[model samples]
Target: MNNIKIKKNFSPKTYLHKYVYDDIRPIIKKKRKKVKSCDFKIVEPENYKNIVCINYNVNQLKQMCKRYKLKVSGNKSELMYRIYNFLKYSYYCIKIQKNYRGYLYRQYEKFKGPGYKNTKLCCNKTDFLLFEEIKNLPKKQLFTYKDKDGFIYGFDICSLWNLIYLNKETKNPYNRNQFPEDMLYKIKRIVHIGNIYNYDINIEVDKSDLDILSNKKKIELKTLEIFQKIDKFGHITNISWFLNLSKIKLFSFLRELIDIWNYRAQITMETKKNIFPPSGSPFNNINFMILRHKKIEYIQEKMLRLINRLITYGKNEEYCKLGALYILGALTMVNNNAANALPWLYDSFMIVS
Candidate 1:
């Protein structure tokens, strides 16, 4: 946006103990003055006629927008923040905003008290997953019709051998500075655990947790060890890589694109359903952990609620494991409740989500 810059020195700005993401209310809230209106004609409670937005009205916001030539299409919250940005920063950064209340509170220790110790969202566990950084494949290249040997080479995949990366520039470098928001490609959560969209799995994980992944479903990390294709002229025709992972799933956004006049990201089939992950063998059961909170009600974790409803209400075992012919999940809510509350709740998974 021409008028605003939310990032300072290649990093997101923090205001009011919260990360500013197109929302400037926190800054304004911090600056709000509790002033009393100096009017004898009308008796009022403290700060009845303050200039701050603590006492807000639609007309005031509109007037501010008109006076500043700001866009008037946003909701009141958006407009309030926009005007605040204009007044304070003299610019308006219009980015997709995410809810950071939970995170900010945790950072500030808002949830810490005598009753609560080792809480899930309030703390970070030491045992987080550690993902190996798979090198990014080279930027796609067009097929060379003829090489020095006069042999035809229409693709280049062989150079994938030296999969070592000294420094890289394939994916957006600074985007992680804005993680879980500006996602290019990431593995969704599987095995009934974690947020489906959380790709921040590059940390070291516990071995027991790793076993859960292996038992549920794994592409076998060994399979990703060797991947290469050389053209007839000893030229690199195509390249492939595992860009990032969420536990078991290794995800790559773009493969070495094959240039057939234009470019199309290649998906070499280990089998027919080349791009999509194949389903595990049938009759494999999926179960979640169930536990009771200290002297509190029992709450089951994972999809127990849904599974129970489907089982009892539907009235059939077949319905319990019915046709998803292929379960393609775009959005999933795999949360932990009291039932699955291990000594550590999802190992601070809820907070990460």
Candidate 2:
């Protein structure tokens, strides 16, 4: 008997490009401005738009052809002509009338708040002074940097590590500017790293209550009081700080913390279920009594709510975590909700895989 070869499903290397193009294509077509007949000049090799102009880079053009399942064996000009013609035809044929309104509505819903604008609050001088204050802090003191106005800044260890790495990599040896552009770039990149971590996390940085003149000593005292109330644990010894970092960093830190909490919650739930069985026998009244326990019921409800929140507000990576949570029965008594969980688990799997 001949064995059948099972084909493995894998994403094409151009998936990111294709996904982005497909997403923006509808909006582009709907908002396309009317052009005169004179505007339809022959697309020269040098004159084509960046999106469609590929002939200039022979290797890139060939890769694009292969990505689109087109004839890859062609001269640079020939490949460019083929890509240009394909894009031109596609541009003309785009019809989003039926779906354009819905797309716009969805976008409006997604970004109904302050939107993705990067607002500048304090001047460069204030930022430079703040950086100077915190930059020379010892490793232990790096996590907590209190500013004036009683604001105690904290940072994620992971993000701090990345920032340190970037600083070492791009340290300007010759120039000694107070706030170098390269250092600023590193800081901004650290914050923006959250977008790569999760999508639902807001990218906006809130600076409504920042004060540069508030006594750092008072802020440190208040932070110490707060920390006293909260018991220290791994990574929890210092709370994630948001001051001075861009919107991306703030959101990424929050998302990372939430994910960590979710993981802990899952482990706690599994341990509780294993140690204390809610069901023992089909005819036992004690099994029913165990389900009625307030502590068990409370934990289950919290787990359900946390998982739902992660599913609703989490990014692609969070979705993957949610899928694992559901499949592994992270919440005890998930059998009752397994029907609903299956769809979410499958959806997350498809997205991540």
Q: Write down the TM-score of every candidate.
A: 0.15, 0.17
Q: Which ten residues in a row have the lowest lDDT in candidate 2?
A: 231-240
Question: Per-model C-alpha lDDT, please?
Answer: 0.27, 0.35
Candidate 1 stretches with Cα past 4 Å from truth are 1-22, 25-53, 91-353
Give the per-residue lDDT digits (tens) of candidate 1, residues 1-353: 56754445453334422444345444455445332344212211232222234635556667667776878777777766666655543322222112343443343232112112322221111111122211121112111112233322221111111111211212211111112221112111111112223322222334575566542222222111111111211222111212122212211110111121012212133321221224311212322121212111111112222222222332233332221101101001121222142213223212232
Q: Tens-digit lDDT track for model 2 on 115-135? A: 112112211111221333333
lDDT of 2 at 169: 28
> Which portions of model 2 show Cα errors greater than 4 Å?
1-46, 49-81, 85-133, 137-223, 226-353
- Judged by lDDT against the true structure, how good is candidate 2? 0.35
Model 2 steric clash pairs:
148-214, 149-214, 154-241, 191-248, 191-249
Best by lDDT: 2
Distance from true position, residue 159, model 1, in Å? 64
